[model samples]
Target: MKKHSKIIIFILVLSYLLSGTAFSADIPDDSNVEIVSDEVSAERYARCYDERNYEREFAPGQVFITLKSTTPIVEDYGVLFSEVDVDYVKVISEKFIVIHLVEKTRDSVIDAIDELKDSEYVKFAEPNYRVYSGEAVVPNDEDYNLMNTWHLQITEADEAWNYSTGSSDVTVGVIDSGVSPVADLVANIDYERGINFLDETEPPIDIYNHGTPVAGIIGAVGNNGIGISGVCWNATIVPLKIYDTTNREYYVTGIVEGLIAATAMNLDIVNISYSSLTGDGMLEAIQNYNGLVVVSAGNNNTDLNYNTFYPAALSDECDNMIVVGGSTPYDYRYDLTEQGSNYGDCEVHLFAPGAWIYTTCADGSYRFMTGTSFAAPMVTGAAALVLSYHPDYTTAQVKEAILNSVDQVNALTDLCITGGRLNVKNALLYTPISCGDLNYDWRISNVDVIALARYLENVLELTEHQLSMADMNGDSVVDNTDLDLLAMMVV
Candidate 1:
């Protein structure tokens, strides 16, 4: 044989022994949770029984009284109405008793409901707002149209929906200020349950359009195709209003109860774009809970290099939750994003376009808003698309696909741990990263040649998959040709 040809043969043989496959643990069995998208526009806002529409769908800001049970009884409205002033009492549904309270207070309403502890009747009483704190607030029309100070790019909205139309049954819990059902942006929303923890009543009227706009960004119904599309156009959004604008206090217990309810409902994702430092219990509950919870990094622009803000960006002990930071449209650092965006060598996870995101609002209107609040639902919507296809993926796995497969950013590597922004297009392209380097230093000795021979002959135990890095020829398979080529090149 010619000297070069012999060298080629020798190199090819040596290459086969060096290439090896790297694999992570396979997906766990219980990870296949399906996305619920078929019921996107079902009787989302109808009365519990689907019988008739109430005069006006209850909004988050409105106050009310909820009786303990659904049984027909005209007892003295005294126990329920004594502590707080009663505006009007009406039976909106069989199971829910409505009391229009004059005062929306925790002490007053809880005291009124507490008085009934001995009565064997009224179940629970609370104020309600459609939006909760830690939930994303949708910016209004002018705000939406304003140039995003973060310089984040708004890709054609349709590009996202092309991947997966969205799962109808998957419920996205909007825990922000509150939302109004009449907004065209969220016109097709499915309100599974509304709680007015503010005044302890049934009707939840959104005083602020914050929650409504966030809801539009995550799950605005599509193909009706009238308004801008949400990340998950076909999913159900459970509006949980838990904020009080008066004192700027968001009840932590209300958040805990919201997550507790979402846990019971088996919601696929909870979008909390709002945050405060006070709610550790609620944050812990969300972290500890088994379902998927996506939270904003926070809007506070303080230095976060030392410590993270709250609930959404909590530690990995609650692995099912994803903490998202905000990115500008251009994928550069945005000062508007909470300075607390980065974590100290911890998983602050992914970033999304949150500067001045535009979406639907209450009262059949549209608007724009900024904050990490808007950024989170973008990930939630993308995760919904992935879950729709890979329903078997656990919350952790889904989070992995998203966090691992994000589009790498330019200068923000220190800001974002994954070093990328959330890109659905890139996420679906992910395969496990490989680590094998079989052909790196292998010599063309007789024994090494024999190992290669055995590997190809199937005599020695060889991994079924091989690293592409070792595939010198660029073909996917790593074999004798690669080994011989490497040996000859060196010899």
Candidate 2:
């Protein structure tokens, strides 16, 4: 009886399909057609559809599709799209095609994709998703000038200055367009030699006006009273130009060569404000170098947990790399930074001020720019400060100090790995505690014993490194037994 009932229900469903009376929810309102698919393919299609926040439709009557095929598509393949009601098709690449739909079928992008996927010649089919710059915030910093740099005040750069303004020995490689010899930049320091991989010159030129500001943020001379101060006042700036003005784009070969040049120079910090889908030779160069590479998390305002971006996405593969996201001055009170900044709990390591940043321009002037591009140099400058203080510190130790010293903020939770923003003062003040130096004075003494006892009694707070040092017995706990051993060592 149950089998008979099931057969009857199936017949009723088949009747609805044959009659074309039952409408499919999968069919969009504008398009009356639906693509039939297996359950697994349907779920995959739905997931992909939900991932994009489509602001608007593509150009009318046109859609882009990427296809993988078992056999090379012949010149006669134009007939394939004609069968699906697509009038014209252009081959973008061996794997990419642009379909021009007839006016009536313009809105049936999904239907066309479904039809193409069902073909035996095609292995897979998907839309060519559009990508945008992640930068969004544009707050005016006119009220706060060089005398009172608001970003410096918020990050407590003054307090950090008490420890170290920056060392001339620390060199920062600005891996962007190129640096300019603007009066504010050149008057204080000579034009340091740098490589222009785009044009193959000794001193890179700033034609596009992007790299100058990034360089200014990293190491513009401070206290000259003429213009703004940078994070590191005395650090050397090396311009490794990779952006090509002719094409108005950054090629992978130029980027790879720029990284190789920077690595060869053994720069203390390499600041990359841009991102690419592929890392290629860049990741290997960074790994081979002894210094740290600070990269922007990109200003796309998307969740990187699922959508991977390069260099920033390669954080796990390279320990010397730090992926930074953008935050606003109001991030502490309210996360009012640019909405376009890309973030991931695992991919992005930290956040810094990126909106309306006032820095050097190409024409010996200053202006405000916004992007993860601007935000990356802040952390790069901070790393420079750390290196200036401890020039001998290993790449891992320097990275540790910067990561551990961030100012914890509730607003950045789950957006970055550190769950905090850059705090230059805290980072500069942080001195990695040696195994037995519980007091963190760079030496083992009776004071360490006293401090350890207070910590055990819950009267004092201990930093992570301090707590590790307090575990004198090497059992990974700060217990009374460890306290006894600490007292013995003190004696």
Candidate 3:
């Protein structure tokens, strides 16, 4: 048959097989079929078509070993193994089988399954949908703008005088398709430390142009009258490419290895613009690493009610990962913004701008791409600034401050997990608890009375070396006056 004829026949057969009430009926008891966990069972997982509103909890994904069998080649079976998004499929042995399904919509998967059900030739169909890239999107510009966008005007003097100007001395790891050392934009940092987890070669080469753009957003060289300015002009970017230039094959181990290598370099932040539908345990180990893991929530347009995807927006196992979802250039509600992003009851925190963005590309070019992949680095830039201002803060404290200081408009508040977009200004304004500013921050407690007694008695002067932190009253000197306020706190 001609190629077009074959495709038409395939479609017709699929339609005929799937159009009937096969799924509508109760699964046959004599069918000898078994229902597996939602993660392993692809049929139960529905795609999130609506991006504007998200669905609640359904089922959490899992990893398991299952029996596999070769599907006999027969026209009777409505299904035929095809490759579009599929890399390859093979049978491990007679009793064990593995097949890589084509990457398509939930509708395609369901259609394939419906066709498979009536076929006596094939035993079963299980999904391996867990493959992912560690990426996510932020909200739109309007959503982020509502949070008040603060632009830093860094003059030559500012760059020289500012201790940590625009993420200087910080290394933001770009773990994506290798970065092109576009000398003009990035200054071509060190490539020796980077590893090609996806292709296993020198990591910094930009074969696909994805990583370079991401790098530009985080730390593009600025102020040389360049094409565009990066969020962090002075920060040193560590390019850790995790994707292949040709035929992007996302591997979990590559991300794990990248995280391990980046952490070993003591990187301040690792930006992952990739995500998968399946969880990789190695990623959890990577998350436990010392550096921060910032991931893209994805552009899949499905509710992340459960941890269905891996890495970025979904890998709940990776403890320290900040899963970022997208918002548009403006906070307009639309279906495209709805799906592929995930949320948790309390965990999925922080949102940034992701839609309709233009940025620099590899080879000194510029392009506009859409996805959660781009959204993450903006926050990564904010993080660099936070570290620049407050070098004493820990990773956990930084995460809290970032989440707490977001722009909380109704559009983002309802859609985003943290209920706001990142605010660089508020984050900069946030102050750690004063050692002894009890009047401004006195939590009513019994200890306040004891501390107050000492203050009044003169036995414990608030300004004394040990009691200086207890100065609730302003006055540069901590004295009995502050203790009176502490006593009031107890009462």
Best by lDDT: 2
Clash counts for all predictions = 71, 3, 46
Cα error of candidate 1 at position 156, Å: 7.5
Better candidate by lDDT, 2 or 3: 2
Q: Write the per-residue lDDT of candidate 1 for residues 1-491, one digit (tens) a residue.
A: 12353244334423432342012222223223221223222222111111211111234223344555543465545344454466666666655656655665444444554454344455554444333232222323232221321211232233434444667766677777766775344454555365566765655557777777777777766555355556665777777778786776676676787788778777777777766665667756785567788888776654354555667435444557777777654555446432534332254566787755657766666555667778888888777766664565566556766776766666567765576678764454333221122321112223333334445556554443233433545566767664454333222
RMSD (Cα, Å) for all candidates, in order, is 26.4, 29.9, 29.2
Per-residue lDDT for 197 in model 2? 75
Tens-digit lDDT string for candidate 3 (355-465): 434466777776554567777776776676666666656564456556666666466565555676665545644543333322211133444445445445554333342
What are the Cα lDDT values of the candidates? 0.55, 0.68, 0.52
TM-score-superior candidate, 1 or 2: 2
Clashing pairs in 2: 134-299, 134-300, 301-340
Instruction: Quote the lDDT for 21 in model 2.
Output: 6
Better of 2 and 3 by TM-score: 2
